[model samples]
Each structure stands twice: as C-alpha cells, then as structure tokens.
Target: MTPSKRLLSLDAFRGLTVAAMILVNNPGSWARIYPPLKHAEWHGCTPTDLVFPFFLFIVGVAIVYALETKKIDISNHNQLLIKAAKRGAILFGLGLFLALFPKFNFETVRIMGVLQRIGIVYFICAAIFIKTTPRTQFICMTGILILYWILMTLVPVPGFGAPNLEKETNLAAWVDRLVLTENHTWKSAKTWDPEGVLSTLPAVATGLFGMLIGSILKGKEKPAAEKTTWLFSFGIIAWILGMFWGLFFPINKSLWTSSYVLYCGGLASMMLALFYWIIDVQGHNRWCRIFVAYGVNAITVFFLSAIISKVMGMIKVNANGEEVSSRTWLYDTFFTSWLPSDIASLAWALAFVLFFLLLLWPMYKKNLIIKV
Candidate 1:
C-alpha cells in the first residue's frame, strides 16, 4: 500500500469500533443492559471489552500509515516525536476534561481513563515505531507481555503479601494506589483502576501487535491474499495461545493481562484481515460508508458524544411530577414506554449510534474530517 493512499478497510474497522464504543457506552439504562454488552465484572472477556483494545490496535495501524514518510527521513525524527507528544497530550487532556466535566472537581477526578490510556499507548507505540526496526518492535512487544505476566503473577505486592490477580490487592492495583492514590484512581473501585500503571504495559503490547500487522499490510512485496492468510493464521495461533495461557494467568481485561492482550490482539488482527480482504482487496466498500464516516472523524465524535451524554445526564426534565435527567426522560418517554427493559435499552443505544452517523455522514461527504 502506498503511503499517500488511504486505507478504506482501516477506516471502516475504526468506524465500526467507534460505533460499537458509542453503542455500549450510551444505553438508556445501564441496569437494563444486555448481558453481552456488559463488561465482565472481574475475569473473562466480553464483546464490550473488545472495543477499547480494537481502537488501540487501529491506532497502532494508523501510526504506521501516518508516520511512514517521516520515518524515512532521519532529520525529521525529532519533529515527528514532538508532534506525536503534542497529540498524545491533547488526547490525555481530553480524557481529563471528560473526567472533570460538569463538576470540575480536581480533588476527586479520576486521573486515568479510556482516552488517557489511548494517549499513553499511542505515544509510546509511535516512538517505538520511529526509533526501532520491526524486529525490535516485536521483541519489545513480546518482552512487555512476558514481563507483565511475571510481575503480576510472581512478584509479591508490598502490603498485600502474596502476588495476586484479585481486584483490589493485585500488584497493579497496589501500584495505582501508590502512584495515583485512591483519590485519583477509578471512582467506582477507588483502590484500583482498569487502566492502571502496570496494566498499561500489556496494553502497549496490544498496540505493538497492531503495529506488527500494520507493517505486514504496508509491505509492497506481499500479495493481498498472502497477507490475509498470514494474518488469519497468526490470529488463530495467538488466540489459542492466549486461551492456553489463560488457564494459568486467567484472561482479564481489568488488569489487561498478557493472555488478554494476545486474545484481543488476535481477534483484532483477524477482524482487520477480513475487512482488508472484503473492502480493500475485493473493492466492495459501498456498504461501509456509514462506518467510514465514523472512522474519519473518530476522536471528534467520541469526545463530543461523551460530552453530549454528560450534558444529557446533567439536564433535568420534569417527568410526571418527578424531576429526572433528560436522558432518562427521553428514554422513558420514547423507548421504555413500550419496549421491554433490555430491548429498550439496546434500542436507545442503537439510536445513539445512528444519531452520530447522521451527524458524520454529511461531514464525511464534504471531506471535513477533524484531525483530532
């Protein structure tokens, strides 16, 4: 693939992932969510868990395409790194803004979040892509996963005694408490965070997994069929390995375990391979326009969607003599008044996805992609 040419498959995959993120995030009622939409309480993976890793994987693939030209000119390396740092900072700042919105409580705001993790992973992975060869990147990715597995399973926690993968007393949780403190950690847990310090190491591995695949996709020597075959094979092998490793470490998204990295990365690789074949290779992309819109201006929609959702919750509306959130009032009036609770919740989320699609379609047609 040429550096200048856009990858429709990638944009479609990204759009699909972002759309899934919006859908899972914006249910009319969290309590009435479908089982598949809910994240696993502690261990195991769900469809919802796949969304974040897939986005990071897409980020890694994008870094390859985005920085291809800059990577060649040695003189441009510093400038490239600076630009990446600024973008990462902006993403992290946006995440912080989301956490601090409405209330703006610095004292109690959660420091790390979905976007914060994305920012950190993207910068580190981009640096790795720039400074290291593909072989070295693979080694770094593998080493991080192995080191995390060892640390989380073998090393003992300071005050917690034994090494553990339990929610509160795990090594990652202990590190989060020590560095971010309970105040800055995830509010729901208070003692630990899913996007904590140590777990991010494996998360970086997930990005590297995508970077490796991106390297393959960008290679000129290989035919499209060969690339698809290799990706599918690698994905299946990695998937099996992840499941086997899970027997010991247990695949957990909350900690982003090494096994989980392999599991999700494997699935992401296969999914991208499929998209590349059907959309990019076969030239059957007409069906992907909706997702393409979401893909091109992904960050813009995500940040805006989150802000709008927060505002929806903040705004109060009188509903039958009771003051409820606008979101609740809308859900009650439009969805739950007729449909079953779980189905109504899902319908609301689907409507949210289409709502953004409607907003993005015109922008996509006009080629007005927001860079951020």
Candidate 2:
C-alpha cells in the first residue's frame, strides 16, 4: 500500500486491540474478572497481556506508514523528528494527566504507565526508522533484547545481590526504586512499576518488530500473497523463538521481557496479516466497520474513556446509608443485582466497549478523526 492510501486492516487491528483494552480495563468489578481478561500474575502470558504489546506493535507499524515519505528525503528528517517529539510529549503529558486526575497527587502519583511507554517507544522507534536501514533496525532490536536479557539475569541487583526476576527485587524493580523511587512507582506495588525504566528497552524492541512487518506490508514490489506469506512465516518464527527464549527468560509481562515482546509481536503480526488478507486484498471488510471506527480515533477514545472512568469513580452516590463511587453504585444496581458476579463484570465491560463504539460510529461516518 502507498503512503496516501490508508490501510483498513491496520485500523481494524488497532480498533480490536483498543476495544479489548477497554473491555479488560473497565469490568464491573476488578474482583470478579475472568482469567483471560486478567494479566498474568507474574510469569506467563494471557489474552489481557497481549493487548498493550499489540498496541505498541501497531504504533511501530503506524510509524512506517506515517513517515515513509518523509524518510525518503533527508531534508525532511529534522522536521519529522521535531514533530515526533512534540507528539510524544503530548502522549506522555496525557498519561501523566490521567495519573494526576481527581487526586492530583504529585508526590505519590505513578510516573510510568501504558501511554507513557507508547510515547517513549514511538519516538525512539521513529528516530531509528528515520536514521537507519531496515537491516540496521533489525540488528538494533536483536541487540537490545539480548542486552536486556543479560542485564536482568547477569548483573546483580545492588542491595539485593544475585540478579533475579522476582516481583520486587529484580534489576528492573531496582532501577524503578532507584530512579523513580517507591513514591513514583506503581501504586499497588510501590516497590516496582510494571512499566518501569529497564523493561522499556524490550518494549522498544516490540515496536521494532512491528516496524519490520510494516516494511514488509509497504513493499511495492511484493505481491499481496507473497507479503502475507512472509508475515505468516516471520510471525511463526518469532513466536517459536519467543517460546524457546521463555524457557530461560520466562515470559513475564510485568517485566516486559524480550520473550514476551517477540511472543506478543508475533501474534500481532499474524493477526494483522490475516486482516490484511481479508480486508485489504480480498475486499471483505463489511464486518470490520465497528473496529474501523474504534481504530480511526484510538488514542482519543482511550484518553476520553480513562478520564470518564476516573470521574465515575470519583463521583459518589448514597447507597443504603453508605457512600459509594458512582461506578460501584451503577454496577451494583444494573449488573451485579441481576447476574452472577463474574458474568455481570464481563457484561459491564462489554457494554463499556459497545458504548464507546456507539460514540465513535457517528464520528467515523462523518470522517471526523481526532488525531492525538
């Protein structure tokens, strides 16, 4: 596909990922979540764990489509970098805003999060794409993954001797504590943030993985069938490699391990390829309308949803002589009252996804994409 022509498959893939994110994030009760929706406790992979990485992978693919033209001209490089930096800053600021909302607690607020990581990975990957060849990008990605593995496994933690991948004492956790301090780390686990400093290295590799796939899809000379074949081939190879790597490194989302990067990116690649084949090549996209709507204005919906969810929690209602969050009251009244706890939670989450789809459908019909 050319730079001017939009990729419906990519948009659909992104939309699906974002929809999953909203579903997993906004259950009626966190306590009553299904296993698939919940992130792996420490070392393993789950459907929920795939969501963030898939989005990051999409970010990488998006960078190629967005900047391929500018990349061809060296003169446009500086201007492109400036624009990327500005966009990254906006993303990071938005994440920070979410963290500070309602409470506005600077001292205790978590610094690193999903959007912050996306912003950081996007800028770095964009810079790499701008300056380097695809071959070089692949090499860089490989080197970073290997280096992270070494650092996490070989280099001993300062206070907590002998490098390990435990919850709070690992090298990544140590870096989180030292740099961000316990105060700025994840609220639930003040000792470490899942989106902590060290783990971001592999996260960038995940983006680079998507960039590679994006290059394959963007190739002018390759036939659509050939491109799909390559996507499937590369995806399978990466997935198998990730599984092998996991034997040693273990696939851990909290740490964003190199293994997890490959595993998630590989699945994301195969998924995008399937979408590309069905939607872009065969012109069978009738069922993808809802995803397209979500995909087009993804960041806008995500930011708005998060803000609204936070507001819902902040607003209180009197419930039988007890003050409770509006979200809790609504859940109790509309969902849990009638259905089983787990099913009710899932129902609420599904409703939340559909609600956003309803909001986005009109905007999509009018072609009103709110770029963030």
Candidate 3:
C-alpha cells in the first residue's frame, strides 16, 4: 500500500470516533438521550463504551502506519524512550489541562482522564511497538488480558478479600480513592471512580488490541477484504471469550474488568473493520467528510468545545425574568426551540457538531493538522 492509502483509513476511523465523542458529549440533556447515545449502566456494552477504546485502537493502528511510512530508526533505544516520554508528557499535560482549565482548583482536581490514559498507553505501547514484532505484540496483548484477569480476580482488596467488580469495595476504586483526591476521581460515581488506577491495566489491552489492527493494516500484502474478515472473526471470538470471562470476572468498565476490556476492544475492532470496509473499501466517504474534518483536528475541536461550552455557561442571561445559560440559549435557538421532539434533540446535537465543524473546515482545507 502507498503511504496515502495506508493512513486514509486510520484518519477516517479516528475522525469517526471524535465525531461520536463530540456528538454524545454535547447532547442537549443526559436525561433525554436516544438509546444509542447513552452509556451502558455497567457490566454491559454500549456504543459510547466503544468510543474511547476505538480511539485507542486507532492510535495503535496509526502507530504502525506511521513508523513504517516514516521508516523510524528503532536501533536508537534512548532516542525512542526520550521521544516516548516527550509525547507522553504532552498528552498527559493536555489531559490535566482539560481537567483543570476554566477552573483550576488544585485541591480537588481530576487526576486521571482520557488524554492521561492515552499518554501512559502511548508511552508503554510505543515501547512495545519498538521492541516487539507484531506477532509478539499480539501475544503480549492477549497475555496482558489474561494476566489482568487472573490478577483482578485473585488480588484481594484491603477489606473486601478478593477482587470485586462491584462498587466502592472493588480494588481499583479503592486504589483511586485512596491515592487520588475525593473530587479528583470520576464525578459520576460519587465515592467510586470509573477511570481508576487498577482499571488502567486492562485498558492497555484496548491499546494493544488497536496495535494488532494497526499491524494488520500495515501488512502490505494483506488484502483489505482479508483483513476485514479477520477483524470480524476475531471480534466475534473475543466477544465470546469476553462473555465467558465476564461470567467469572464481570464486564465492568469501572474496574476496567479484564472481560470488559476484551469485550469493548473486540467490539471496537469489529467496528473499525466495518467502517474501513464501508468507507474505504466500498468507496463511500461522502457522509463521513464532516466528521473527517472534525476528526483530523480532534483535539482542536474537543478543547474548543469544552472551552466554548464553559464560556457559554458562564455567560448567563435573563430570559423572562429567569436565569438561563447562554449555551442553552444557543442550543435552543438553533437546535431545539422550533425543531420537533424525538429527533429534534438529536438534530440539535448534529447541528452543534456541524456548526463546530465550520470552524475546523478552514484549517482542514488549509491542510493544518493537530497531533500530540
């Protein structure tokens, strides 16, 4: 494959994940979401659950294409480590910046986050990429999943005895709560955290899973259909194994349950294959263009949206003698005010995404790219 074709699919895939991330994150209201947009409560898979892992998988895939296309010299181990540390620092900083920006409260700031996970995973996976062959990476990936499974199930929480994929009593949650601050953890679960420390172990499997896809995509001789077929088959197999594992480990994202990792990673791998088939293989890329625009500059769009959302929220306005957020007003005026229900909310989000894309289209048209 030529350099261009190698990464086109990866870009589209990354863009797809970013588009979905923004869409779901910017929904009008969490309470009034379409079923597809909402996250699974626990121990189950959802479209949203696939988003982060998909991004991680895409990251791995791109790593292969990038290294091959650039012909990165791997003999220099120190050079590689330094590069990894720098990239990891940048990504981790971005995550922390996001967590603290517009409200930099040091006392109880978010310690772990999406970008933070990416940074750590990027460092570790990059090292693995340089040191191991694709086959070895695959073996290591599976090994990590299995090892995590055994560890989580056997390791006893301070007072809970063995690992529990339940609530605050679980080992992972306990570690995060003990190490991180009360306000620094995932706010949704109150006392517990979904993005806790121990959970990150299996999360690495998600990145390794991506690396496998990346290596597959990088294989010059492998036909697209063959690759896609393998993806589907492996996805089904992983899903089955994950389900069986879940019977013993339970598919909990909070714990980053080993089963949940395989399950989500499997689902993400399959989805990547499907998207590649549909958009690149089938040559159907029209609808995905807007998302592509957003995806190419994913960090830009995401950071902008968060900042803009915060700014809009801060600018409260008096409407009919009642306090109203400026952001809500914007959403209502353009998205929900006159639109019908059912899909009006969805449309509003789509519109928000589109409007945001307008800002990015220019950068894309100018061939400006943002990456850490």
Q: Model 3, 15: alpha-carbon shift in Å?
A: 1.1
Per-residue alpha-carbon lDDT of candidate 2 for residues 137-195, written as tens digits (9 for 90 to 100): 99999999999999999999999899999998899999999999999999899999999
Models sorted by lDDT, best on top: 2, 1, 3
Per-residue lDDT over 331-368 for candidate 1, one digit per residue giving the tens place of the 0 to 100 score: 99999999999999999999988988778999999998
**Backbone clashes, candidate 2:** 0
Candidate 3 segments exceeding 4 Å error: 1-6, 69-72, 332-344
For model 3 the local lDDT of residue 38 reads 78
TM-score against truth, every candidate: 0.98, 0.98, 0.90
Model 2 RMSD vs true structure: 1.4
Task: Report how far off residue 222 is in candidate 2 (Å).
Answer: 0.4
Compared with the true structure, model 1 gives a TM-score of: 0.98
Which runs in model 2 stand beyond 4 Å of their true positions? 1-4
| Candidate 1: regions farther than 4 A off | 1-4
Looking at model 3, how many pairs of residues clash?
A: 1
